[model samples]
Target: MSPSVLLRWALRDSARGVTASWIGGLGYQAGLILLPWCLGRALDEGITPGDRSPLLSWAAATLAVSVALTGAEFAMRWWATLAGVRTGNRLLLRLSERVLGWDAVTAHRFSAGDLVTRGTRDVEQITIWISTVPSLASGVLGLFTVLVVVATLDPMLAVVGLGTVPLLIAVNLWYPRRYEAANAALSAAHGARADAVEDLLSASTAVRGLGGEQVLVERHHEASATVHDRTLALARIAAGWAANAPFVPWLATAAGLAFGGLAVLDGRFSVGGLVSFASWMTLLGRQVMMLTFRFGQLGDAWTAAGRIEAVLSAESEMSDKATSLLPAGALATDGVSVELPDREPLRLPDLSVGPGEFVAVVGPVGTGKTTLLRLLARLADPSTGAIRYGGTDLRDAAIADVRDTITIVGQRPLLLSGTIAENLRLGRTELTDGQLREACRIAGILEHIESLPEGFATEVGERGSTVSGGQLQRLALARGLLRGARVLLLDDVTSAVDARTEQRILDGLRELDVTIVFATSRTAVRDRADRVVDLGVHDGELVSHG
Candidate 1:
């Protein structure tokens, strides 16, 4: 989207706040304008003439304006702040929901670390800008209004008052681009550093086991240094702007006021008028500074919003199929083919399994068995042929419906961070206690969990981190069973468990037919297959035929 669209979209959501903030801002600036006016009026009418009536009127007006400004400032602060936070938080939730909607392939295209930054840091940066934006905009307009009034009252004093304004406006216009560039680089550095640190912590066991602690540390240090350098560069840029900002304004203001002072002494200007002009300059100068700062933050926020938009707007490899399929129990692939990023093509000549029929598929590693199963699951599209359900093309069916119909039991199942029971159920709430126990039994994890102090209700820690590899795998298996899919694709499910447990799991699954396509490299499972899909170099040509 264009920059104008971005600005309007960001602020328009908080329309009520924008209105409330400005109305209250008008009140605040009215008081600021009246403060000098009341002082000048008192000097001209009461203090100069020694009349108590003018003094009393000026004092009352001052008190009223003071009270109004205070109340208005408070209202604006609270109203704008709440609105910004609410809008930012709602947008963040929407962004996260969109992220979750992303398909596996789309998600893999971006780093998890970058996503974290966009969601948290980037969203917050924009929120802060929004909180201050309306008031800042209003304040700038107020300054301009005050300058016009001063010019009408007395042009010479007004010119002296506005001596610093043009220079300040120029600085404001020029500062944002450089500031945004520096901050964007800093954000990228921060993302890389976060990635490095997360990797080090996540793979601590591997690093220590491989005696590569020093290597990981060096890598982390390097990433940290890069981030540090970028951060320092941002600091330097901000500092340069801050220091150079006051130079032109002060020089112009000093020279104008010095010359204006002689006119005042020659009865060309009143004392109260001169004071009012100085007051206008101070007020306008502050507003100019606020506008500069506000716009700079808006620029940084815009940069962040653009990155977030890129991720949110990304398209999936498999486009959406809006046609919903009635739930059915069938799966098949005919002449399925797949091509890797840089590798030769692999083919699946034919495959069929009736509903509720458990079948084993045995092959050496890299036999394209897993790839074939994933295509059946619609995780990736087949290159040239179709996978079907009950003679209907899978690609033509509703994607959400298809996914709901099948679940894959992968080699390494990453469970969400939660309680054991929570991870097992995922989001489905239809499973009963008895059914859950049966699934755990089938997955060879029931007895193991019964021994724990909390049993099924135990917290599994982040990503099931508190559990061993075998245990986590069993938890994943239980999750799949709880899903009650019409088709179950077991891809090396036995890779992590002991032979006895594996045998128990296989024996339990044999009772039901769910169009199972079990992919394995295990010698023990070879004899269990009704058909073998060989994918190896046969003769001169590479071959794959079931």
Candidate 2:
């Protein structure tokens, strides 16, 4: 989807609100024209003739119009705000849904910072544009009305007022291309700065331990300087435009005043008519200036929309076709090979494990044990071959169904910043408290959890920082278990737990009647497995021993 299409869709979605805002704006503009007309009427029929009754009547009418204008302005603002918020929320939800549908590998191409900027800051810019639409529309309507009113007072003055339109258009056309280019550069700088900050924060501990703090700080400083330079450049362009925008309007006002004065002196115009024409010209000038400013803002908004549109239109790693759910049978990999970026292919020998079997995958470092588990979990598709559940190829199975039947616990588990129960029931929101406790007990972390001040309700600080390493692993295990998946893939889950805890966890697993495939180097864990597949062989043979 292009930005133009996205913006059109948003407008359609909030059509009713947007229409109401435009109506209110037009009404307010009409009221503004009435105000100047009333002043001219008071001057012509009552003040100059010294008639108290007509003057009082005109004064009352002006007051009434002022009140009506206030109400119209209020309505315009209220509906515009509603339209902006509604459209913004819709865009945000759509972006989130698109992100969620993306496979792990595809999603990894975007950094957390970049995604955040697109979803938040970019969305805000579009919303700001939506809100300004009513104002711009009203300004145009008001400008035309002022010109028409001036023409009625004096045709010569109207011609002078109309001259400003082309100049305003020229100013807008000249500045936006330059302003937009600057805004795009500024936006890139901001995103780069955000990425640097996010990278530093995510690896703060590693940087500190490796004595690379200064290095990272310098990198961040460079990113910040780039952002500052871009921002300064953008500000300079805006400043120049701002200083030049007023000149067109000023020139129009001066010409209208001089023309109207000559007409009045030549007995072709009344004093009241001259005042009314000048008032209309002044209002027209203000509207043109406002339009020019909004045009600049629209340029920035367009750039932001384009960025968001790029993400929304990106292709997902997985196909969108609906497929059958995985059936109960052996899990097998045939001629499976995975080639990571800039790395040699890790090929796995053809192997199959019967349903409900416990298999241990053993391999030295860089032998692709974790990669095998990731492939099984559908994190990434094999580059060369197919993985099958039962007789059906994994690629033909629905991705959501595959995920529901198979869950993986990574070596370094990530816990969200929430209560223990909340983390455990991340995806399985329907799980009861009792089910949560049972899963935790089976993972061998229930005792530690119960000892906490709030037990299941205790808040686990960001990334589970409040818990010990062992506890974090167990919590993740519990979360996967609570999903009730038929196939559980554990990638060195017991690496952090002590031997006794690992034994207990393995013992509890034996009673689940589910297929278990885990990668580990622990002898005890291998000893407990029904079969072990070694990946340490030079020829990449299965080397299964029972």
Candidate 3:
């Protein structure tokens, strides 16, 4: 979606809250005019005329207005908050789903840290804007009320009223654009810094092992300094606008008061009319001030909205259709080609697997083994390829249907932060204790789980860091098997484990009826595979063994 489209949706979602906030500000602004009128009346008929009765009555009226304004203010705030919170949630969820739906190669194309930043930090910026932005509309309404109140008291003062508003508008529009440009720079610098930090965090051990702390630290400092300069530039713009706004109003109000005083003395204006002019000028000054503040908020929101739009606008690698059921235990790939940007495509010619058949992919590094496996699993699509299940092409097949029949365990296994049983039951919610235990046993992770204090309930740290690499791989295998996929793609899963462990895992998988396609660097490993295809590169293009 475009930035404009995203913002339109955001506004619609938060309309109720935004409206509430507007109402609250209007009520407070109404009190601005009413309180001034009450004071002017008391001065004219009570204090100046030495009438105590009128003073007491106007005092009670002021108190009642104050109470009502307070309620209005609170009510508006409550609703605005409600709207903002709900909008944030919906946008967050929507953005997250889009990002996660993208393919592995596509997902990795964007920085993980930047995505996290957009989801969180960038999202926060809009909330700040919402809190202050609706005031602009309310302030305009308040200005109108002030002008009418002045016109009723004296038509002469109303003639010069709002003379400075055009100039104020020009300044508000100009300053915010400048502020936002600087903020854009600031946001870019911060996102770069986040990417750098995430890179370092993920490779902290490697960096420390290689004694590259200084290099990382220097890179971090450079990123941080750029962000600091951009932030200061944005602040400067805001400061300039804020400092100048008040002065413009001061000049306008001063001109009105001096001219207004003389007109009254000349008998062209009344004492009560001059009182109204003073009140309107005060109200106008505040309105101008609020106008400047809202401009800054909108500028900030515009900046944030653009970044969020970029992420949400990102298209998935390929569109997935609605879920449709495909038959069980069948797979095929016909003249598949895996295309990488700025690189020649990798080819797989006519590979098929029957129900209960085990197949393995063997090739050199950079060969199409892993790529072929990825295609079969639909983790990534093959350019100019036909992947079919039973008699239907996978492209025509519902995405969920394709996924339902195939599960892949990648070279580097990922385990969610959960107990062993919880991780195994990820895809299958209906797994019984016996079934869960059986899958774990088949994957050879049952012994490891039994060693832990909590057995199957033992907590796995973030990404399964609490377990050994061997254990993580085993857990992944258990998850795939428990899903009962008719086909399983194993991509160098044994790379982190010993030969004994690898043999045992393979032995268990060998007895399964489901197809198993494994990629391995060693010839010995491939020899044991049910079927092996050597990925031979000729003329910088790949050809499989016939």
Candidate 4:
């Protein structure tokens, strides 16, 4: 989606609120225009002639307009804010939905921090801009109202009031181009700084272990400096424009007052007409300032919209046409291959595993063990050739169906910050505590959880930081087991555990009525497998041994 399309989507989604806001804004502007006219009428018909009746009537009219304007202003702002927030949240939801559907190949296009910034800060920018739209529109119409009112009183006064307007508008127009460039630079700096901060937080432990905390801190500081510099650049441009844009309208106001005073003295204009002309000139100046500021906001929003477009427009490489349910049977790979970044392609020799068999894929580090598991789990597709489950091509089955029958536990599993029970349940609220405990027992994590002070209610901290690496791995395994998938793919899940615990997990897994595909280099795991496929045993090819 382009920036224009994104803007149209926002407007279309919140049309009712935006329409109501526009109506309220027009009401407010009409009241504002009437106030000065009412005061002028009182001055001419009553105050000048020393009659109190006309003056009193106009005073009540002015107060009534003021009250109505107050209510209209409230409605305008309330509806505008509601519309903006609603549109922003809708855009955020769409972005999240797209991101969740991304395959591994599509996921690598942006950093986690970049995506976060686009979803949050960029959305906020667009929301603020949307909120300003009603005011900008009403203010422009108000300026014209002032012009028409002045022209009715005296065309010469209208000329005086608008003498500098064209020039002021040209200057205002020039500011957006410059402001947009500065805003875009600032946005990019913000994304980079966010990425640096994310890295510092996620890898703080590793940097401390390497005794390179200072190095990481310096890197973050550099990123911060760039953001600061870009921010200052944008602020300077905005400040200069704000200070200058409204000043020209003031010059027009001074000219209008001078000419109007002469006309009033010469009896060509009434005292009341001069007062109304001066009031209209003041309104024009204020409107110029407001509209210019809104235009600047538009520049910032355009930059944000472009960034949002980048995220929404990214297409996934994986196909999603398959709707067939995956059948249960043997799993096999036919000349499956995957191209690796900065490495040789992984080529798997033809292999087959019968139903309910335990198979192990063994290889040295970086030998594509995890890649093969990912392919089998359908987390990604093979670059060439195909894998089949029960004689049906993996790509020909619906992804949801594939995932329903297979569960994969990665080497570094992600555990959200929550209670132990919540992590295990993962929205499957129907699963009882007994089922959770039984799954944990099979994964060799039940004893550990029961020994905790809070038991299943214990908080796991962010990414399971409170737990040891081995314990985190076990918890993830337990969670995967609770899925009750027919096939389980393990990617060195037992690497962090002790030998005894690893053996215990393996023994428990053997008793389950599920197909097991384990990827590991440990001798114990391969020895227990019905068959072992070792990628390291052959150059660019997998070799199976029984």
Give the count of colliding residue pairs in each prediction. 3, 0, 1, 0
- Candidate 4 accuracy as TM-score: 0.93
- TM-score winner between candidates 2 and 4: 2
TM-score of each: 0.88, 0.94, 0.87, 0.93
- Candidate 4 per-residue lDDT, tens place, 383-454, comes to 898988888888888777888888999999988989999999998999999999998998899999999999
Q: Which ten residues in a row have the lowest lDDT in candidate 2?
A: 537-546
Best-fitting candidate, scored by lDDT = 4
Question: The CA-based lDDT of model 4 is what?
Answer: 0.86
Q: Write the per-residue lDDT of candidate 1 for residues 174-267, one digit (tens) a residue.
A: 7777888988888888777777777787777676878788777887899899989988987887666665665654554565466567777887
List candidate 1 stretches off by more than 4 Å.
Answer: 1-7, 42-57, 103-105, 246-264, 427-438, 511-513, 522-546
Question: Per-residue alpha-carbon lDDT of model 2 for 244-283, expressed as tens digits?
Answer: 7767767877887788788889999877777777677667
Worst 10 residues of 3 by lDDT: 537-546
Residue-wise C-alpha lDDT for candidate 3, range 73-119, written one tens digit per residue: 78767776677677888888988888877888668766887788788
Candidate 2 vs candidate 3, lDDT winner: 2
Model 1: what TM-score? Answer: 0.88
Best of the two (1, 3) by TM-score = 1
State the RMSD for candidate 4.
2.4
Error of 1 at 466 (Å): 0.9
Who wins the TM-score comparison?
2
Residue 98 local lDDT, model 2: 90
